[model samples]
Target: MTEPLRWFTSSHSNNGGQCVEVADAQDHILVRDSKDPHGPALAFPASAFAAFIDGIKTGELR
Candidate 1:
């Protein structure tokens, strides 16, 4: 059986209207708008999401 998604926003988030929520969904990372919890989400493979975060940290995503 699949585990339930435990969604959360970033701690650095200031409750602004542009925030997004993220969750771990087994092999993928699920992302959705905070304003629409029941709305559609975009999923990325775990490795891909990790690489994306690394890129951001290194300013490669800018």
Candidate 2:
């Protein structure tokens, strides 16, 4: 059965610009632009999402 995604914004978001919303689904994490809630979302595997977060902490994303 499919479940509805509960989306949330980052705590750091201050409504300045270029924000994003995230939601955890059954298997993967969902990412979407805050500017367009009805727009497309990018799904990343759990491990990949962890790695992406690690990259940001280590400055590898830059």
Candidate 3:
């Protein structure tokens, strides 16, 4: 049987109205809007997700 996906957000997220939720399981990484927990999620490859985060941290992409 396939395991259900688990979601988590950054602990620092509480400070801001903007928050993101991520699910790390299966072959792809899942990202969704925390404001709408039941909304459709976007899936990306693990590497792609990592690069996206790196870009954000380095201010290469926003």
Q: In each prediction, how many residue pairs overlap at the backbone (N, C-alpha, C within less than 3 A)?
A: 0, 0, 0
lDDT of each structure?
A: 0.93, 0.89, 0.87
Tens-place lDDT digits, model 3, residues 1-62: 88888888987678464688999977799999888988999999999988988999999997
List model 2 lDDT by residue over 1-62, tens digit each: 67788999888788865798989986799999988999999999988998999999999998
Give each model a TM-score.
Answer: 0.88, 0.82, 0.77
Candidate 2: C-alpha RMSD after superposition: 1.8
Give every collision pair in model 3.
Answer: none
Greater TM-score among 1 and 3 belongs to: 1
Error of 1 at 58 (Å): 0.7
Error of 2 at 28 (Å): 0.6
lDDT of 2: 0.89
Q: State, as a TM-score between 0 and 1, how close model 1 is to the true structure.
A: 0.88
Whole-model alpha-carbon lDDT for candidate 3: 0.87
Model 3 lDDT-worst window of ten? 10-19
- Compared with the true structure, the alpha-carbon lDDT of candidate 1 equals 0.93
What are the runs in model 3 whose C-alpha is more than 4 Å off? 15-18
> Highest lDDT: which candidate?
1
